[model samples]
Target: MAPTPFESLDDYISLPRIEALALSPDGTQAVLTVAVLKKDATAYERSLWTVPSDGSGAPRRLTRSAKGEAGAAFTARGDILFVSARPDADGEADDESGQLWLLPAGGGEARAVTRLAGGASQIAAVAEAADRLVIGAELLPGADSLEADAKLRALRKEKKVSAILHDAYPVRFWDHDLGPAEPHLLAIDLDTLEDTVAAVVAESDALATAAAAADTETDGATDAPADAGTPYPVTLPRPRDLTPAAHRTVDPDQVAVSPDGATVVASLQISEQRGGRFALVSIDVDSGERTTLFDEGDVDHEAPAMSHDGTRIAYLRSPRSTPEGPADVEVWTAGIDGSSPRRLAAGWDRWPTSLTFDRDDGALIATADSDGRGPVYRIPLDGSAPLQLTSDDFTYTHVAVDRFTGDLVALRSSWIAPPHPVRIGRDGAVAPLASPAPLPAAPATIGEVEATAEDGAPVRAWLLLPEGASDAAPAPLLLWIHGGPLSSWNAWSWRWNPLLAVARGYAVLLPDPALSTGYGLEFIARGWNSWGGKPYTDLMAITDAAVARPDIDETRTAAMGGSFGGYMANWVAGHTDRFRAIVTHASLWALDQFAGTTDSSVYWQRIFTPEAMTEHSPHRFVRDIRTPLLVIHGDRDYRVPIGESLRLWSELAEHHAAADGSTVHRFLYYPDENHWVLKPQHAVVWYQTVFAFLDEQLHGGEWHRPELLG
Candidate 1:
């Protein structure tokens, strides 16, 4: 029998994926970042594709390079701007840091705009009414400007120095080390490209001339090095340092420029003792002047969206979580200059994430997690209830609102579908737009299973049914939990996907228990500081409801999860011996140890007291675990460090070991991968190893190890 994509890990990894969507100024065409496996099947390369906003024509490929194109945005001139490390195909050296490139709207080849040595992270914000653009770039801590930053970087490379001196709280993020370089927002005007490059080149010429004269008189050696001169300017546009003397302050992703390009609104990461919160600020793009729009240490002001007329700003305010309870996010709108802020949709329960202004700036187009789906809502400034525009199971994101027709263009995805572009009309009608990549077909059927928790709260799950699962031949069940104790199992997941399990004739259940979002603040608060209590009970209730179906075999079951879900998996292993096997990835075994060691330690510490954390920790009842377990972790996982798994491994070997020091449990360790199996080959091996383990426990084998494991 020929295997489908879900049945074959290699085929599944080669599937094309759409990453993001960006609409043009007139909303005539939308640019999409599509990724597909490269020739060698080792890495994924991204290219830009354009789809019609009116759903009238087929999607056209816009840009392509092996270096990968991303962060697609449109300038006021309708030119498509993206970030890519792709060198000039006309014969230029490859760039390690991605440079900002622009494809002319009229019709021409793409051109590099700002040539920085460190490469631009992404296009932060593009002005709607002007030729100005703000980009997220990195500047060395000691350097005063980006030019100096480039020279310093060149000098460091020359000296072969890779060490970073840190005096801050977080020296590293999830997978990579935090800097010697500070992230900065740079504002560049497209019209002044030639003049600014000329000015910079002239300055370099004068400095070189001065150095030459001095060298002639001295030992023929001065400070201006050769590599420094290399990055100066073959042809580069200068960028205004909108943020100066920044120390990991600016939140790179949450930034926006007003339509006129005169003002920029951004989220600033304010670091505290153990962790940090974000604050919103407005800046003068040209003058580099900044004003404090909102900054409270106890609360986070994030996702700032500018009004089209460039006057008002809409943002979300989230009070810090405490041991008492988790806080609900409140959507607020205020003047661009920080005046008269008011909350929109006063009693709206959904957690709105990304926000944008409507066509006329009278209402905010916001995407919020709602009952297992992320839907776009039109929130009126009059404080009326939000109107959900798209009524579908697919989660919508990166919504682009039409300034003329008041239509919305966004990318929506679900468990059954990859991200696909859709055009939403003014009358709340959704039209599927042309996509460069077709959605992959799922091998199993998706159905809903819900139950009432012991506390009378509703718990829900997505059940994947195999083709032959019936009362005559019941299929074994796999209860898969979602991470983020604060997240919902609503969207399509490249990792932790259940289609592979269903393809193997095992029914899979994806449950969103207590502490999951979209159910409102009260629902999340139910499991607050009590990870083992409400969340665990909620999961069991939903799993019980799923197993009650005649097609599912409750006796042959396994549990799996990662991160917060991993914590629950460990808790479940200790609390019950019902499951035949359990798989926990990057799990937190000891709550006390995790609270102090995790990347965002401050936030978790505040949410759970020491005693409360210890009381609910999974490690406390390790001896009670009887189910055969497969522990998975990546050494570089700082979010839930490898130490959690290391300690758990030691305890399992100590207690569950036989007289010959052999145990039924297994440990799948990734020395190079991070919290997630991001690399294509690694992801293939991940699913392979997982399936092998499940086959051993569920079908009774001598542990059929995956081929690549050796």
Candidate 2:
């Protein structure tokens, strides 16, 4: 057992993570994004690096590409910007939409600042003192420009037309296909994008004299010329459209801008045919006009932030959750024409996961999920009581703040560290920053574990263990769960990593139960819409307190999860047969056929009630299954929709069949993964088929099969 990199899934998918962190409104540095694993290990590139924010030096890569870079932002003239479909170190026209590059804060070589036909698709909100920015992207709503949205995306890639005319309620999204083009916001400017880089060299010399005057007036070739029909991107300044939906969505992570960049604010969405709510608008970024700054109907106004002396904005609000529970998300703020509004932390019982403004907006850094940690708080806009900030066990995310050293620049991580970059201070301290990827040896030994809940409420988890179990070689547990049954087992998850099942000797757990989420909103109304009740008795009371730990092994238990922990691993394989095997992944067997086929069950149809979503349905306990399950899915999972694991492998073959059409159940199927199995060789064939189905159901061993599951 001497193999590390958590027993090597190609050396833990070749480490190096640090997913994002931008800061630099003169807070003195940060740009982070890191990513790695690309020598054809099938995807994961993201370049940019930098780091400095006063830990005074070390972490410098800064933008290398092969279509790599990520959404790094900064520009108030300290240029950095990012997002990249990369191809144009002066070579342009590489599509697949991701443009907007930049780099230069008095430096060189990062160019391609927006060629965007449907690209520059992200940087939503830069401006902390103007030069302007916004850019969410995706257009084509009756194409009134960007060369008629690149001639309607070159006539849908010249007529191969992958049809998508959904007049709205989520036409696909956990694996793409959301539209024929929608999400807009836009706004750009950057000094009219450096005076349109000489109008992109005079529109590439008038597209070489209109392709030699359409080859001498049709005396020859033509794919569109005479004067050009699809050649638009005059290099920069042409964005301006602010949320003109041909079908909703402007919530580019709830936008922001306005620090004298004359407003952008955002969150938009508003559809409502059967599920859509976010409101808070604003716009005006030089007359794109817009206004409804905080529209209230069923309420949502998402994470906005704004404030940097451009007069307030903040945001969060939430509101729609019903069938008797889960609501309170508050936070608020207002004024930058959103006027008055208020509420900042009014009763803050946590649930933020991100929101900025401090460094003189006088409080509110946010990053919630406490008690299983995610930390970084502060709060303060007069309502008081929040202050936490960084006290350890990681999680925090791209955080930022710094407004000139009031300090922050986040990215933490844990379950033994994976994401890196630090620099916290303003009393929270942290420091660390010098990472082109460093901390990798955790392979297992985490700890924590608690419980109580039989209505006394409390359950928690974590565990891990491996480098040798105790009390006579024990370790075999697993459990796992968590998939936002309102999420929380707190962070560091390169797609669920119990250090590859404690390097394969098992012992996992993780938990957080009763509809998790940093535990509040009455512990998520204790499993709201009763998800198989109290998140399955707060996950069997935290797996019976991690099988009353003596290095665990309650007679070799199992149980896994994916979506709502795969609907609580199909309600713990039809209510416990005391675990020998039961995996799940992308689960949710039948809640009245997943409330109108997922991808948008409108917050479970406004807090459930199709008889409380088929009253805790695990396909109405699939004929009380007695274990041996292992399903897993993907066929392009549109958020728990691979037809809910093909109807839970056709009802585990109509209740565990075995007359000859045998079935100790084991579906697997990836068909080009989604709903997380994200490449890198399908996450090394998903932990080598969940450690070869937990080594043939808890060490009875033989039954290998994962050679690409041939």
Question: Which residue pairs clash within candidate 1?
Answer: none
Measured on C-alpha atoms, candidate 1 has an lDDT of 0.86
Tens-digit lDDT string for candidate 2 (1-710):
54678778888988878788887778787888888898878888889888787777688897777779888888877888888887764434556568787778989777776776678767877887778788777876767667667756766787778877776567887898787788777777767655356876887886776557545654323354322453554555667776665366665777887777877777877777776788877778777778787777887878888778878888888887898888888887878788878886667687786788788787878888977888888888887777886788888888887765587878788887777878888899897887788887776778788888899987878888888899899888888888877878878888888887887777787888877888678888877888898788878888888888777879999888888888888888888898889888888888877777888776776788788788678888788888888888888888778888887788778877877878877888888888888888888887888788788878888888878768
Candidate with the greatest lDDT versus the true structure:
1
Clashing pairs in 2: 484-487, 562-565, 562-566
Q: What is the TM-score of each candidate against the true structure?
A: 0.96, 0.32
Which segments of candidate 1 are over 4 A away from where they belong? 1-3, 89-94, 195-231
**Cα error, candidate 1, residue 523 (Å):** 0.7
Against the true structure, what is every candidate's RMSD?
2.5, 23.7
**What is the alpha-carbon RMSD of candidate 2 to the true structure?**
23.7
